[model samples]
Structures are given as C-alpha cells and as structure tokens.
Target chain A: MLGDIKTVAQGTFDRYFKMKELYVILILCILNIAALSRYDVLTLNMGKEFMIDGALAILTVVALITSMAVIFEKSRELREKTAHFIITKPYGRSSYIWGKFIGISFLAIFNMAILTAGALIVFKLTSYENVMANNLATEFIYAALLITAEAIVLTALGLFFSMFLSDTITALMVLVFFILGHSFYILEKMSSESSKIFGWVSDILPNLHNLDLKSAITDNITITQDVLGYGLLYAVLYAVAFVAASSMIFSRKDIS
Target chain B: MYAIETHNLYKTFGWFLSKRKVHALNNLELKVPENVIYGFLGPNGAGKTTTIKILLGLVIPSKGHSKIFGIDTHDPDTRNHVGFLPENPKFYPYLTASDFLDFCGKIIHMDAMERSKRKDELLEKVGLTHAANQKMEGFSRGMLQRMGIAQALISDPDLIILDEPITGLDPMGRADIKRILLELREEGKTIFFSSHILSDVERMCDMVGIINHGQLIEHGSLDELRSDIGVNIHTTGVASNALMEGEKLCDYITLKNGEAIFTLTNKSDKDTVMKFISDNGGSVIRSVKLQEELEAFFLRRIQNDEKAREEEVN
Candidate 1:
C-alpha cells in the first residue's frame, strides 16, 4: 500500500513534468514582466523593489491560476465515461484525484520559481532604481515564504471546489471567487469609516490582497510587522481549514 | 475456484427528476473459467458494458455481488491482476504513444526502467511501435483502438477485459486485433470481450454468453450452445408435391419452397429423419443439417424473441 501510494504520487508529479504546460507558465511570466515594464512606477525603483518588495506574490497568483487549470483540464478524465482504464487500476480513484492535486501543485511551485527569476532579471537590467537593492532582494526572498503559504490556501480551496462540481463549473466558480477575493480589500478599507455591517462583511471575506504586494514593488513601501504577522496567521489558518475541508470532501466524493 | 464469478451482479442508477431506478444489470450471474476467451454478446443496451464494468470494479454493483479470481471486486488488490479496455476508449490526446503506456505502467506500480521495457514490448505486440512517438490526437480510429489495447496490456495483466474491442477496424486491423487476442489466449490470459462482431467472437471465443434485456439468455461453450440452438437443417431438392405430402402431418417437420427441413431432436437422429422422407414417396435429394454460424443463430434468436413479443402484445 505504501508502494502504491508512492507510485501514484510520483506518477502524478511526473505528469506535470510535461513541456507543454511548462511553456504556459513561461509565457505568462514574460507577459507579466512586459506589463510591469510598462509602468514607470515599477521603473522608478526596480532594484530597490527587488531588494525590498515581494516578487513571489505575482507568482502566487499565476500558480493559483495554473493549479486551477490542471484541476479542470488534466484531471478531468476521472469523471468521464471512458475513465475505466484508470479506474480499474489498483486503488485508482483516490490516487488519481490526490495525484492530480499534488502534481498540479508541484507545477505551480516550479512556475512561481521561474517567474521569480524573471523578476530578478528585470531588477538586474535596470540600473536607475538601484537604491535599497539589498532590502528589495530580502523582501522578495521573504515573499517566497509568504506566497507559498498563500498557495497552500489557494490550492486547498481549488480542491475543495473540485469535490462537488464538474471541471468547468469548478473553474468558473474559482475564477469568480478570485475576483471576489481581490475586491475584499476595498471592503476592508471601507470598514474603517462606513457601516459596521460593511466592516463585518469585509472581515468575513478572505483578505487575499494581503498576499499581493505589487504596490510595494512599484512605490518602495514595506508592510508593517503587525500586518505581515496577521496576514501570515490568516494564510496559515485558511490553508489548514481549506485543506481539512478539501480532504474530507475528497474522501467522500466519488470521482468515478 | 471459478476464474471469475458474479452472483446476481446488478447496477442501478436513480434519475433525479423522475426518480426512476434504472437497473443496468439485473441479477446478472456470470461464471468464467480460467484460460478461455469468453464472448459477451448482446444488442445495444443489453447491459453487457454494465457487467464488464462490475467485473473490473469501475462501477459499484448496486445489488448482488461480483468477484474476480475469488477476490471481491470492490477490493483494490483484486484489480492488480486485471486489465481493461473500455468501449470507445478515451486516451490523453496530448501524450505520445510511449508516454501513455508509461503512465499506465506507473499506475500498476512498475518501476521506471521496467515500465519503459514493458511499454516497448506491449507497443510492439499491439503493432503500435512505429507510431510510438506520435500524439494520440492525430491517430485514426483503428490506431486509437490499437493504442487502447497496448495500454490495457502494459501491466501484463492475467485477465484482459475488452468491451467491443473491434467496433471500428478495417479487415487488416481486425485481423491484427484477432491475432493479438489469440496470442493472449495462448499465453493463458482469460480474454473476456464484448463484441457485436459475431464473426470475431465466433472465430476467437472459447465460450460465449448471449444477453438480452438485462438478462443472460444463454451461456455455455460455443459447441454446447450451437448444438442446443443447433443449426436449421436445410434439406434441398425434394420433389415438390411428394416432399410437401411427405413433410405434412409429420408433427415436427417444417416445409419451405420445395424443400423439407426440420431440426433434429438429437445428433444421432439426423440420418433417421432423412430416411423418413426417403421412405415416404419423397427422395432425399440433398440431405444436410444447418452448419450453425453464430451470427445467423443470434439473428434467429432475436427474430424469435420479437415474434414472441408480438404475440404477447396481440
């Protein structure tokens, strides 16, 4: 049984080693860098932003997108009528679902790492924003720690959604929730001056904006320790909660 | 112990709106012995696929029980020795031929090197080595079906379950598939396949089960069932009026167009029946018994079933 699970895990990860999906991540990174280059704000302190800001945040978003893509596309055979080939294999159904989840997550992490290097290259080529380069580098490096935490939460949520829904609906629903998650930052700010109910709603929604430090990269800002710690705690809590829920749903759900 | 057995295997689905229960396999009882190709024959919607699904543990049997090699089908370990090719097999369109087999090997827990070696061997056996590097998206129907067979054998399973393994193949492709199935049978694999192609089944199967309306109408060795439903003895060239008069009033005789024909109650009685016609004013111009072809036998069974239904309706 241990061997069975390991083989499944290894095969699942090996699927992501495909060159086609890897190209998608590379294309996304080049596009991201090109978009960032268009902003003069990013040009102002490119090196400082690298030394002091979060590079992995962009990757976290991209990784989430890819994770959701693999969930819908790569692992869809489980629900199809012709999946009997895989379903008939030894202990197949659970292995496929979990294997696909792990494989997609591994690919996402690798994509994040690649994009981080892309960000680094941009910082190195531009000399105008050389101030606080060391700080920016430290900030970006720290971003890895935080964004990975964010990724766990995102992947867990994606897996949770995959449990009860078809691939298309799950992907669409995740995309919608992603938009909603980003808008919650505006709601969080409004909670300070507006109605108490509005503040309560903001509190209820996952504050995914904390995972994004793009403004800091462009404007040479640093997140406070208190905010970082709170965001880290929220990320951890959300990851644990969602992963637990995902496993429970996955255990009960019939992919076959 | 039986090589494969099913005790009242049934699969049911509940339609949400109408709340109707669809029993795909209704109390299906099956037994397949070792080292024999079992042909599962049925018209569309006869639950042939459903029974195969239960055998491979792809679907949960809603009622009754299914076992493979004496192990419960629901048990994961039971599938370790089994392989399957589903109807209209869907493969990963993006993976190259070798890569797909490697993937199958991995699921069966073969190490990478062994997986690679086995992949090549199975590919060669299925006649897919030349197209080994080609992605399946560009493969023709025959190619896809061949690839499906290769993947099914990647693990070198002891039991190979194929559902309509030859639905869309050219004569050569069909011959190739038939050869592979025969080879597997020679290697002592229990080759259980469902096919509408009775010729393939007739030429390949050692034993066969004919199913209709979610029921097993007949199950036995081909020779056994053939002799049971046996062929219609076509007696030809009898003198018209003499043959008619001779056949008439003979309670078991049937006449058609200048020939007297009837099924023998036993093989030993064929000569006796022919002798009767010759003795009674009619000369047995050409005496012969029907050489049972599986297709014709099955069609006759189907027509008989239809007529029975019509009579009941009237």
Candidate 2:
C-alpha cells in the first residue's frame, strides 16, 4: 500500500511539473514580489513590509489557484474515465487520495519556497535599512510556514469537495470555505449574540486564523514556537479529516 | 475455480427522480474458465462494459456478487493477478509510455529491478519501444491502444481482461494483438475480452458468450455455436429433367453452366440427394457441410432474443 501511494504521489508530482501554466504562474508571482520589494509603489518608505505582506498574499493566491488546477485536472480524469487505470489496480482508494494530497502539498511547499527566496533576494539587493535593523527574517520564515500550512489544508478541502462535486462546484465550495474559515471569529461572536447554530458552523469550519501569522509579523507581535506548533497541529488535523472523508466517499463511488 | 465468475449479477441506473430506470444488467450469470480466451459479444449498451466494470470492482452490483479466482472482487488482492484494459483506455497525458508502465508495475508491488526488466519487455512486445519516452497525449488512438495492452501485461498477471482491445487498430495491429493473446493463452493465462470484431474473436476465442439486452443469449465454444446447419451437394451431367427429381429432395437447388447445386437444411438429406442424383445417371462432384459464421450466428441470436422480448411485451 505504501508503494502504491508513493507511485501515485510521484506520478501526480511529475504531471504537475509538466504543466506549463504552473511554471508561468510561479514566474509571474516571483516577478510581482520582486517588483513590490524594489519599488515602494504600494506604500511609501515601508516597501520591505509591503513586499513581505504582498508576497504572503500572492502565495495564498498561488496556492489556491494551483490547488484548484489540481482539482480540475482530477475532475477531468474522472470525467474522461482516465482514473480507471489507477483505481482498478491492486490498491485501496484511500492510498490514491493520500498520494494526491501529499503530491499537491509538495508542490505548494516548493512554490512557497521559491517565492520566499525571490522576496529575500530583493530585500538583500535593495539593502533595506529597516529590514536589516528589525531582524524580520525569522518572522518572515515563520509566516511562510504558516502559509504553507494553510495551502495544504486548502488542498485537502479541495480534494474532499472534488470527490462528489464537479470541478467548478468544488472550486466554489473551497473558495467559500476559505472565506468562512478566516472569518471564524466573527461566526463565534454571532453565535453568542444570536442563534446557537452559528456556533456549530464555526466548529465545523476550519479556523484559518490559526494558520494566519501575517498580521502578527506585520504588527511586530511576537509569534512564539508554541504558537507555530499549535498552528501546524491544527492544519494537520483539519487536513486529515478532509482526506479521510474523501477516501470514504471515493471508495464507494461508482466509477463508470 | 473459474478465473472469473458472476452469480445473478444485477445493476440499474437512475433513481426515484428519474422517470425510468435503465437496467444495465439483469441477473447476468457468467463463468469463464482459466487458460482460455473468452470473447464477450454484445451490441452497444448491452452490458458488456458494465459486466467488465463489475468484475474489476469499479461498479458495485445492485444485487448478487462476483468473484475473481474464487475471491470476492471487493478485495483489492483479487486484482493482484488481474490485468485490465478498459475500452478506449486513457492515461495521464504527461506521462511517457515507459513511465506509465513503471507506475503500474509499482502498484502491483514489483521492485525496481523487476519493474525495469518487465517494462522493457512489454514496450518491445507492444511495438512501442520507439515511443517509450514520448508523452502519451501526442499518441494516436492505435498507439494508445498498444500502450494500454502493454500496461495490462506489465504485472505478468494470471488473468487479463480487455474491453474492445482491437477497436482502433489497423489490420496489422489487430493481427499482432491476436498473436499476443494467443501466446498468452499458450502460457496458461486466462483472457476475457469484449469486442465488436467477431471475425477476430472467432479466430482467437476458445469459448464465447453472446449477450443481448443484458442477458446471455448464447454461450459455448465457437465450434459448438457454429454447428453445421446444413449440407450442399454438387453434381453434373444428367439432363435438366433428372435435376428436377434431385431438387425435390433438397431445400434449395441451383443450376449454372450445366452443373447442378443442391442445399439441404438437414445433414441426413445429403445421402438421399446423392442417391437420387446417382440413380438418375448424374455423377456427384462434391459434398460440403455448411456451418454458421460467427457474425451471422451472433446476429441471429440477438434478433431471436429481441423477438422474444417483443412477444412478451405484447
């Protein structure tokens, strides 16, 4: 079973790299981050902070789009009956889903690393006094890790929705969840003021705030190791729940 | 145990919201023995593909059950020795032919050394050695079909199931597939395939099952199903009046260029026709037994089944 998962993961990873659009998006995002850091166009005299923020935002978008592309390709495989080749093999459906999650998550991490490197290069070449004096390097790395966690969770959510929904519908659901997940605090407040159902909604929705370290980094609030650890744990638990549900649903599906 | 067996397998499509339910398979009972090429024949939407899907555990049977090598199909291990090529097989577009085969090899738990050896052997066998590194998206339909066959054999499985394996091939390609299948049979591998090409099936299949309207209309060996339907007698040189007497004993009689031909629906009538021709001073040239062609037999069985269903409805 582990061998099958590895095969599937390797296949998915190779296929994604072959996609020209993924590289196109990656290059565009890197250039955007570089331009933001070199020129203070977004905010005057605070180009370094703006670059970091813009880079993280761009990473989130890139992760969402890339993950959506994977889901859409998966939908095409199901629609075109290409998945029959893998599903009919001597492996369980859970292995296939896990392999897909791992493959896409690896791609997400790679994308984040490239973008982070591009941002750091621009920071060094420009020799931003504030960036060097404030020692924001560690915080930037922590923020990037947080974004990676969010990207992985979103990939899992996309995979779960894609089990029964079309690609378009799955993307819509993932986008909605992404929005609701970030606003989980507001939902919690509403539950105290009004209907108790909002409490359930907040509980059901993944708390993206747990994985959001951008504000802390930007506002100069200290993000300790324990917070980062808890965030990673939350991401893993949420992603696993989604992956387990996807596997259960996929195992029972009629792939005709 | 049979290599593949389905007992009272049933499947239906649509639900309460739909006005009608499409019964894809109704009590389909099939038994395919090991080490033989069994051809599954049916018209479009006649449940041939559905049955194959069920055997591969792609589709759950609404009722009844299916087993592979005496183990339930729901068990993933049942497919360990089963290789399948779906109709119009599709693969990861970005994967090369060799890479795709390697991935399949890994799925069956073949180590790197065994996978590499088996991958090369299969690529050469399927005539895709030249396209080993080429991406599958650029391949023609015939090339994809060959790749499909290669992947199905990468595991050196005991049972190979293919759906419409020869649909997109040229004559030479079809002949190559026939040769491969025959060679596999010689190695004691059970092959079950469905195809519209009855001529190829007739040449290769040791046994066949004909299905119509989700039911098995005919099932037996090719020779048994194509049993001798009649006999033909050829003779000459007696006079047109003598031909008339011989014609009375036969169901069909034709004369061209002073030679008379008689076709009898019963093999027993051949002796009587020969005796009559000889008594009338005509010499018998030859007698040949006429057997049904597989194509004709398949069509006749399906037509009879349709007629029976119509009568029942009426």
Worst 10 residues of 2 chain B by lDDT: B266-275
TM-score of chain A of each: 0.71, 0.90
DockQ of 2: 0.71
Q: Per-residue lDDT for B1-314 in model 2, tens only?
A: 99999899899877648979889999888999999999999999999999998889888889988999999898888987888888876788888898888888887788889989999999998889999999999998878888888888887889999999998789988888898889889989999999999999999999999887777888889888886888777778766777666667888788867778888885446677778887878887887878888999988888989999999999
- Highest-scoring model, DockQ: 2
Cand. 2 Cα-lDDT: 0.84
- Calculate DockQ per candidate and list them: 0.42, 0.71
Q: Model 1 misses residue A132 by how many Å? A: 5.4
User: What value does DockQ give for candidate 1?
Assistant: 0.42
List, residue by residue over A123-151, the lDDT tens digit for candidate 2.
66776757645658777877788888888
List TM-scores for all candidates, in order.
0.76, 0.89
Models, CA RMSD each: 6.3, 3.6
Clashes of each: 7, 0
**lDDT of candidate model 1 versus the reference:** 0.70
The alpha-carbon RMSD over the true interface for every model, in angstroms, is 3.3, 1.5
